[model samples]
Target: MTEPPQTAEPSPPSGAAPAPGPAPGVTADGGPSPQAPAAVRRRAVLAGTAVSVLLILAIVFGSRLLRDFDSALLPYAVATVFLAFGVAYRYTVWISAPGARRLFRQGWRSFFSAANFRRAPTALPRMIATYLGFQKFLGARSHARWAAHQLLFWGCLLAAAITFPLTWGWFTFTSATGSGPGYEMRIWGFEIIGFDALGFLGWLMFHGLDIAAVLVIAGAAYFLWRRMKDRGAITGQRFAYDLVPLIALVVISVTGLLLTFSSIFLHGGGYQFLAVLHMVSVVFTLIYIPFGKFFHIVQRPAAVGMQLFKYTSRRTGEGEGEVLVCRRCHEPIDTAPYVANLRGTMRDLDLGFDEWAEYCPRCKRVLRGAAYLDHVKKGFK
Candidate 1:
């Protein structure tokens, strides 16, 4: 008795392509999408890289203007250039990692926010103390590990703090009035920072470096001990992961100390050979830092950014768009794209963990424990 009213469908224009269905978890309006358009992302990455390169070049040019780029400094300059290239390549690899695009988007927004700026003064101190100073959280779990890290950390940091600027020509020795190898450009102005051009400051630099050398040696010794004696702590340790960096650090530190000692004790006799050894050691370490265990330094800043964003989001009642939460912990995990990629990877590997991909670290641990108990109970039955 009733003819249902039929809705009319609109037809596509003569040569038009059919409208594509929305991708999984993507809205028609494109809101809450985990990734932006590829073109936009590429542009953002390129722009950021360009700015960094430009800034580095400006600094180099300014340094050249401030001081002569003499033959003695030429090798260091080339090494610095290679170091910059290594950093850039490593950064590119990081940004290309799974979930990195979304993380970077959130990080960029958070970094420029006024709220983050307001919190910076207080937040920076905590970051420096907790992260840069001792890595206190790791210390809470293992004192020996923490002590080793602190030694390596501060030794590298202090050395870099002084050396980088000196290499960049930001500091020059007033006592380096002659062009010979005996008078070298120094870090921290020869006159400024309350040091006479020749005597006390040079002594301080040498002793300060010696102190760093001792710390590095102690740290390397601890690591080597752990590798040899405490095998349980490092389940799958490889030589590249454990021994190589440790050995390299030890060699670098020992050679540097030797150079210092030779200068101090031998009145710089055979200084040429010592200097060459030190230079080669430093160049190798610099080349290796971006690739190996030293990447921890780069990752630490990323961790801080993530921490700051999380803190800001909680404080401001703002949520990262399309947030996925852990099933057990109730904490936010990664965005949809990351979860999707993870699931795809698991499926490809036949891991059967597609459903568990979004679980946070704490939730994963608890769930694993529960599964173990269930397995034991069934075995007893």
Candidate 2:
């Protein structure tokens, strides 16, 4: 256990030991004593409250004390507040777990360490590009899956960039010449640019949401098709957890596009209805983010830090030629520090088989099979 950094944000009482914080819920006597449910809830409440308050303040200040705020988008803004609260609450509860807590500490602790950057400066940036940005891990599964995921990720990102600011009143659009073809865009009560409403740039600017919606629909539709048709996907499918997110995206996108279609093609007929429908769908998704599979979006970036931690740890040990190998296959499984962290996490999890982390996956499975046969088959006789 290394001494924790001085500025341990959200510190969990990590002492002056020469290591990461105490294992998930480690007792002073070196045994797992899982976190109390009440304590976890308390932490979650604090996190949620802090986040909600910060976001609310940002909304207030960024909107110039409601000067630019739109009353019509009030419900959307409220839903986003709830979204922030829920995500913080769930994230706090999740990291309270032994394994998750350890990893969380390890990832962040390594992140703040100056030694990590001194060894390899570009390591973090390279990983963010590959792991979080490109999501190359998904490509290992299938190219189609990777493509669909990229579309979905970028679509959601684009939609969020446009939607959240607009809803919070940080973004505003006004006619430059009293509702003429020229228009001006403003963010936080400051003019960004002026453009012709009939020009290509204006078309792209005004229709950005439509483009994002189309991307979302395409990506989600592909996934929905796969889930319905693929045998393997069907075996692990859950309607609410998996399918509903995609379905909700489709509904929101389709309704949003219909809103544009109604204005452009139907002379504003059914515009109000489509707008309400779109709002409802967007509201539902925002509220659903923390509790549903969308939580993975928040969790994924933090995992990139873990990859950096592992990388730097190994590089730090390169000169020593120290590598942790599988107990059976003798193949390198992970860096010594990483494996030690894993075993510590297992111990914190109250999983007695911490030694299992030392073995390769194939050897673990083989041992499991042998044990099952020996114990069960012998017991039956």
Candidate 3:
């Protein structure tokens, strides 16, 4: 689909040198360049290496020198190690751009600042509650979408909370008496709790993944249904970015639930094959996370910091001067500091349209419409 029109300064004076290309080629027909710029490659490599090393160290420390690590869960652990590296690498590349770098720096600064925390103690958590926890913003668009997202988010959250520690060896389960009914749980080599294998607690514990699978299946199915049926989604969706995540989720969930069914009802008829299929699905999904829509799961928390920064600033009358007003509509656009930060980012990017940020969204659309009429429509005549 065509992108929204951008407002720029009227044509530059004659014979000027072109500005540096600061924007990444997001829509480049051939994907990212094979010979990426040296600096970008360097940053990605360093970040990825650092992340991998830290993950390795964590696994080593948490697993008590691999004593608690299950050999059968090796594939899951390996996939997560790669996942951490890939996520860090992509994140480093993503934040190298001027706009994203600005946000990254400011978000962390506000997130970590003692003064900001003191001034607005509840701001960060509040943003996290509304934005990340409940995803209240999605409600403004569609209630169905909001509900689906909540299910997906909570399901994924629960799954990660359960799986990561287990895969990483931070958690381990053992037979309390070297037999069936009773079980013992350990956290980082310390005895945490015990429960009966056939009791309600054991049913919930053993079937937790099944519950997560059901939630994910419901949520992913809703999205998949919408993608298949909704014209708006169908028109813009890409197979890799849009469809595959949901498909993978459904595959993982179904195959997972099948493992349970095979154990309970099928008497392990297809349990071994189902386990292999489930593992492959999960491994592929983990490897694909950094490159696909699921990367947003990693990125969303950073936004809490950004939101906290803005909210605290507004509430405390901290850094902002007067609010900036739009030129065309004469209505408020945003706080002066925010507008200035935007202009600064634009200037750094050599966008040649920092002034455009001063106008509210409505006026910018009006200006773009006028320009379109004067230029493209007039030329057609």
Highest lDDT against the true fold, candidate: 2
Please identify which of the two predictions, 2 or 3, would achieve the higher lDDT against the true structure.
2
- Candidate 2 residues 1-381, lDDT tens each? 356667846566547655744233223221113454988888888999999999999999999999989999999999999999988988888788877788888888778889887878888889999988899999999999999999998998899999899989999888857975988889998999999989999999889999999898889999999999999997746677778899999999999999999999999999998889989998999998987778888788777878887888888898785579898999999899889988998887688999888999999998887888798776445
Clashing pairs in 3: none
lDDT of 1 by residue, 1-381 (tens): 144436564443546654654233223221223354565456545654675576467546646664633446556656766666656655655655445545665666777887677865577558757876768887887998898988988888877876666666666654344532234544423345434335666567547778888899998889898988886856655566557889988988998898887888999887799778888878887777766667666667666666666655655543545567887776978655546656765675587878988898888888777887788565435
Q: What ranges in model 1 sit over 4 Å off?
A: 1-59, 116-121, 176-191, 197-202, 318-381
Worst 10 residues of 2 by lDDT: 24-33
Model 3 per-residue lDDT tens digits across residues 1-381: 144436555554456655645333355222224556789979898999999999989998999999988888899999999999888988887777777778777788888889888887888888889989999999998999999999988888888889999989999888857887888889999889899989999989888888999999999999999999999887756777788999999999999999989998999998999999999999999999988788888778877866765665565564444667797788977766667878989999788989999999888898888898898897446
Sort order, lDDT high to low? 2, 3, 1
Point out the higher-scoring one by lDDT: 1 or 2.
2
lDDT of 3: 0.84
CA lDDT, every model vs. true structure: 0.67, 0.86, 0.84
TM-score of each: 0.67, 0.85, 0.86
